[model samples]
Target: MSFDRACRVNVGLREPNVAFEKEDWAVGVDRGRLLVIAEHVAPGVPAIAAAVRSAPDDKSAMTELAWGLRGAGLAAYIDWAEDPEDVQEALNSLRSRPGAMSWDWWDDEDCEDCDEAEVIERFLGLAGDHSRRYGAILFEIEQGGDGYLVGFMEEGSVGMLVDNRSLRVVATGWQNRA
Candidate 1:
């Protein structure tokens, strides 16, 4: 199991149309912004992350993850827009570096006994060699709160935290559990 320090949110309050003040996060994406994008995003590049984050596939968090990975010399999972519309421009920054490929398609054809930790070790090695981070945005549904959290690992250890109150984020971090 993964280490978890997740906290609860107050259920009675309404989620605000807020944006992350942190530079590491996507801008202009709160409740209202997401609603607007839900209608516009296509189905190709926005999948798993959308389900995890509660944001549409075209929203900021997933885009940022793709962008951040490519920008930092890592492989990008999606064939992002080269000159995306102003709204889609954020994803254009991360081009695949030389000798890089999106780790999403990692092959395990030769190792049936690889097990979970070995697979994670291999993924982490590749991510570290390329300076790429891995993470996911999961909604904390247990508390009946509309809070979304980023569970991530950038260059070192993993972490988990939620945006509380007015939806302001002080930081970000995630990786799928092995």
Candidate 2:
């Protein structure tokens, strides 16, 4: 079976539904650095969708807005969906499934003679170790040498609000997760 990522985040506001009315905003982080803070058409922050015309394909094209560091009082009220373990689980699934040679090697015919060490490393790269509360950030939407609305943000960095909550949240999260 294929893995699906259907995560969402709502901050200090009622979540937007498909019927209309998406008045929530979003924040993007990268490499422990704050980058772009934008608004969403729907209440879905982490939910992938278009800026205005949301569709399955529009997830990475949402518009961005300018907000200050910890200016929005949303850090405290932030709520998001479950952190995804899709890539990690998918890689592991290959190990338990029948007809699969091993989890450390490539399955495609192109890698018939590929190096074993490289193959294992590449396969293991799919697994991510994310913060328990802040969550894992594995992908970014970059094009033409920049991350669309998140150009200022780096790829694979955790997004966080620059408020007192960030310290407590991160500290507590790590302590608990650790």
Candidate 3:
């Protein structure tokens, strides 16, 4: 669906134009629909798995995860930009660090009003059911103390939440779920 249908305007921002405001970030509705404007960026599963094991919480794990995925493989070269010209610049920045996730544009530095524990709890609440129903594995990685990374691997999609500020899909593929 579109952002207009799936997103509730973030009250913290005066206008929603992707500006660098604390509240400009938005999350998809709990109903499991997302308003993704950019193309999907493939994530590094090996990196994601390693970060998950080392990071303290979901948010921190994502920061590390983004770094891993940024330089993973063929998919690492892709860039998501509003303008085509900006693609190279974004890709450059992404590659600059080599193995770190960027949580710079979070809505509220680690879910703002929501606590880490609470965010994890909520994700568990929603993801548990979703994972069970879809036969997918849903998880949250730390974007930092202020953000989270939530991910879901299903028959048709591979998604992750960066800093818990937003959810981005790296790959949209299907796997036979038994």
Candidate 4:
């Protein structure tokens, strides 16, 4: 919908309906980094909507959103949905449906996309491997603009970009206020 009114949730609250392990949150955070990069590099592009809607359901979308925030280096404040069960109910009918569902409307445009389960699985596998190796998650959200910035942060780090391969910081902070 309206990016201005786009809501955000953290990973420490109630877990979404879909099964989201710590690994899922790690990956979600990583994805968030990429969304942040897109916002900076492609001002009008709706990467967040695209990515979130691509999930199988609201729980999946929420998990994916958390990853997106983490990817953007804003991990500290991304709280899990307060009432994940409600979100689950909102998406129950659509969980195993066979069509793209509308997640939001952006400027009169409905944001709809089929959930890419395979792609998500691949990313999770990658993240899980990294998590096992370094005792933390290492992920890169690239916009391929001024520079390809790869953000490395502990799986549980707040919002600090521990390592940046390319561009410097722009806006860095936790989205949720605890």
Candidate 5:
């Protein structure tokens, strides 16, 4: 099975004239869906025009924009710019979890009879389920070949990362660490 490992920046832009420099990275901006994965930049890197346009001058504007993005079902990771304190608190709570980076089933011995594909599917499903529960934004990280690291960002910061392996998901760490 093949997986598309490209990490896309999904944005909901108010402006229609915005364009990107790297044509290769430009996925396409379709207003019809109101959810466009237009730019395929490296993970954690925001699209230039989207970033600039989303960024407002004042705190009130920033908060308003952040809400607008969220309301439009856009996962822009704009909470950091909107409210850093709340985001930090959420991160702290996530990191404090005893099982944040460790799981009992995350070992070969624990799932010796388990199929690799099934394990991957379960991990992905869990990630999605948690994302919805926490109202988080999902990010994908390419880990070479068929390997991928999925991150769930809630309240602007990363709350969890899951991988195909029963091991090394947490060991990989967050953001650039992957």
Candidate 6:
């Protein structure tokens, strides 16, 4: 089957019908898919499109865009206490699924016997480090035809794709699948 993956974020806008160039935002993103997602999350807002245009620079654009979305009630920031548990659970669950593979060598360490608590602790530590070093972290879960993909995109990273500043693919057992 053909690969299909989607990343969705809720976006709120003051002016739903504000006209903006969708193509100019998140350049690497699929416009058609974004349009559909925009329709579903906040009809007529085109939040991503607007934010990209409004941001000051390309390096900080995603961070600015995310903040703008959060301010408008479109996106959410992870609460380290509770959210990391859920994120850990998702990662552990993905490990059991077929075709699971670690995108980074560090993430491939032996953890077959690790319990929920241990997993969560590790995840929290990682999240903490990411936040301290990268300013903020944006969690993303992508559902694909083959499987699910998870990521922690750091604000310090350049481009839409993850780079040195981004968190390791530990939280996503099937990383880079998108």
Off by over 4 Å in 2: 1-126, 130-136, 139-178
RMSD values, in order shown: 14.3, 16.8, 16.4, 19.0, 14.3, 15.2
Q: Please say which candidate is ahead in lDDT: 2 or 6.
A: 6
Q: Lowest-lDDT window of 10 residues in candidate 1?
A: 138-147
Q: Which scores higher on lDDT, 1 or 2?
A: 1
Per-residue alpha-carbon lDDT of candidate 6 for residues 1-178, written as tens digits (9 for 90 to 100): 1111211121121221223343333333333333333233333456665655555654245444445444545444433344344554443343111223332333525445756445444554454344334343333422112211233333343123222112122323213233
TM-score for candidate 6, residues paired by index: 0.30
> Model 3: C-alpha RMSD to truth?
16.4
Alpha-carbon lDDT, every model = 0.29, 0.23, 0.31, 0.32, 0.31, 0.35
**Candidate 2 lDDT, tens digit per residue, 1-178?**
1012111221111222212223322222121112123332112343311222232222122222111211222221111221123323432332111232233423445335646433322332222122221233222221111111111112122234222111111211121121
Worst 10 residues of 3 by lDDT: 169-178
Per-model TM values vs. the true structure: 0.21, 0.18, 0.28, 0.22, 0.26, 0.30
Tell me model 4's lDDT, rounded to 2 decimals: 0.32
Model 5 TM-score (2 dp): 0.26
RMSD of 2: 16.8
Can you give the lDDT of residue 28 in candidate 1?
A: 32
- Look at candidate 2 and tell me the lDDT of residue 68: 20
Kindly report which residue pairs in candidate 5 clash with one another: none
Candidate No. with top lDDT? 6
Please state the error at residue 44 of candidate 2 in Å.
25
Better structure of 4 and 6 per lDDT: 6
